[model samples]
Target chain A: MTSSLVLGLELAYWQQSILRSLGILLAVLLPAGTFVYLFLFKMVSFMQSRLGPMEAGPFGSMQLLAEVGKWIQKEDIIPEKADRLLFKIAPYLVVSTVLLTYIVVPFGPDMIFANHDTGIFFALAVSSISTLGVLAAGWASANKFSLMGGLRAAGQLIAYELPLILAVVGVVIQAGTMNMSGIVAAQANGEIFGFDGIGSPYFITQFLGFVIFMIAVQAELAQTPFDMPIAESELVTGYLTEYSGIRFLLFFIGEFAAVGAFGAIAATLFMGGWAVPAAWADLNNNIFNLLGPLILMAKMTLVGGFIFFIRFTMPRFREDQLQKLAWTVLIPLSLVNILATTILKVAF
Target chain B: MSEFLRDYLTVAIFAAVAIGLLLVVLALGKLIRPVRPQADKYLTYESGVDAVGTAWDQTPVRYYVFALLFVLFDVEAVFIFPWAIQLETYGWFGAIEMSVFIVILALGLLYAWRKKVLQWL
Candidate 1:
């Protein structure tokens, strides 16, 4: 987990390639495996209020495969008179936008592609693009319910986006940099302009920023208490009503990937991103260095688990309630966070 | 190997991996749902009532006003962006050019507003 050893630059390109490929290969496999094991088998069974996947691979692991097979065997049906082009393109649009946000996410200090300065802003901008696709799918299906769902998604995306961007700006103002790495760096060494620990972990200086960031992100993900976009009972799975076969699958995968990405970003920005927890900080440098990325993963899982807990504990909010929460509560709170951060920046 | 071959090989590898991942994801998803075959199953469900023909039929005429207004403002803003970006360099000359353009746009909006055409159900 030491940043230097993590890259293994001393190794030949081919050796490095071998390790990189192996790492990504395993990275791809582990989560996908857990997704299949956890949600597909365990959760679905839990959903039915029954013991699940008990007979197959350990704890019904193979049941995910079986379920996948069943979804495949179903007919690929395009609704009669649906707008063929938009209907076909919408799922791709949604998934591609979600995947694009991954470019700046730091899995470890060395584990990112181009860190688009204003990485936070770049993400917020791109995340909003999915609403267009959802809108197209909803309107193209020509289904009233689907259109309403899509419209809801678009409105929710539009409204929450303001507060979400404002919240990120609050953090950016506190750190005085849009570069995520720089923001995290500002948090390091635990001192801000002679104020001990003010320049420390972002969550410390901009705790309000951190709080708003989490809320806005959860809303952006359309998670519990904020998932007005795809309220099934209200919108019949919303813009997704017309999709079948692979297209439908892409939407969910995009959704789950989004959940993971939000957790990663929150971990990176507010959770000290791979920084060893304080108790472990007292250990040897050699030990702490190796433990950082691992600790980051633990942090990510903790945030991810919070998402699952939220989903389980809350019910879908009424559409009006969702709007009111965003406009009244989240917006004012986010604005206050930004104002406070700005004042601190100027004062400092 | 030739450069052409290298280029083609790289493109092929990229395409293959991306396509492969997409296909596997979709394939796995398709394997998960229950498939029952019936005429009703094939039909679009509308609260158990038969869909009156297809679902993707025409919407009300009111949306046209919204669409037209969106296009008008969107184009106006779009045209202004280039001018706005270069406003400092162009100074008075650019400001005059933009004001004339906006005046013409304002007239159109005023005309539309007077006609009560902007309102939609």
Candidate 2:
């Protein structure tokens, strides 16, 4: 049974894939947005022993929905002196790059939109384009605070991008394919710790890569210790200072979507994607393709929860210290991990 | 269309959809949201002080140096990716080649470090 095209255009084989891709994009955004809002606010608030946004929905669950309404109705402010064109386009550029990342995300077994051979590579490269949007937003704002924010973003993302890609290389080496599904398949092949009955995830063998990736992702998301770019206390909401209302809302959505996207990538890379645990090893049967996305979402929640937990708990790093952590620390560590991984791959 | 073309087409379509969504939201918000402009609000915010000359001041050159350094290492890191995916087939031969490449890059980083080029002013 195939989905009917509403546009009245005759469908071809490849068009079906595009249709399915658009369907997944439409379906995933609501849940992804909800998951980001609730998980971040609740987890951060719970850490601080405070109730967050409880008045809006049950335990403030409906708060983000209400926020969307309020933001849509609020005034859209473009500063008078700002570069009007870049100011307007920057947020869309960011949100679009992030939204595009969902295209390659493997939702389930054979459940991906586009199963490119360069899947992981494609996702990383496209997401980096959001940094340009960030710089544009900063430069066009005509605010010194925004300029600093943009520069910090450029410096931080550029420094962390190396380690992030390098860390993934360890997993890519082990998995033998850049395809997201192939990485999951590699993880599902056998048990880790031999007797533990859990699938041997790359997280176990590539522990250093996992650590570096997590740190780099934290920086990539610009949260907490790595959130120097948009630190409210210092930069007055940083690059976002001049933005208000709907344009600001675009950046907000883009940031959360990026967190969700990166979390999905990390889940796919190190946590065995959609692989059901050993107890459900038999359930890994290809027929239960629907279970893949559910399993993947569960893993994402755990990883994302941990990331938000650390975000809430950690203090902001000094600017130089943040760069130092990426270069002097994560880069060298990821390199060592790659060397070790190569040796193991050769010997075994 | 060929599958390769379709794959990239999906990316283009996704981008179009996102931009379209942003435009829709902004247009909708413009219909609903209140627009109140005042002369005071238009001035650049300098801790609420009156009338700053201009915000487009010269930023320190330190950020430029880091960007240059980033380009150097980031380009070097890109080579590791293709080598990584093919590591098993080429075995020790590929491994040794990668090590020399990495060692050279490491020396560059070390050289920059000793030169204090990496140090934040």
For model 2, the interface Cα RMSD in angstroms equals 1.9
Per-candidate alpha-carbon RMSD to the true structure:
8.6, 2.6
- Worst 10-residue lDDT window for candidate 1 chain A reads A1-10
Worst window of 10 by summed lDDT in candidate 1 chain B: B7-16
Q: Evaluate all candidate structures by whole-model CA lDDT and list the values in order.
A: 0.62, 0.81
Quality class of the docking in candidate 2, CAPRI style: medium
The candidate scoring highest on lDDT is 2
lDDT of 1 by residue, A45-79 (tens): 68668897787677777876665555566667677
Return the clash pairs for model 2, or none: none
CA deviation > 4 Å runs, candidate 2: A1-21, A190-196, A277-287
In the order shown, the candidates' DockQ scores are 0.11, 0.62
Q: Model 2, residue B33: displacement in angstroms?
A: 1.0
| RMSD versus native structure for model 1 | 8.6
Model 1: how far residue B65 lies from native, Å: 14
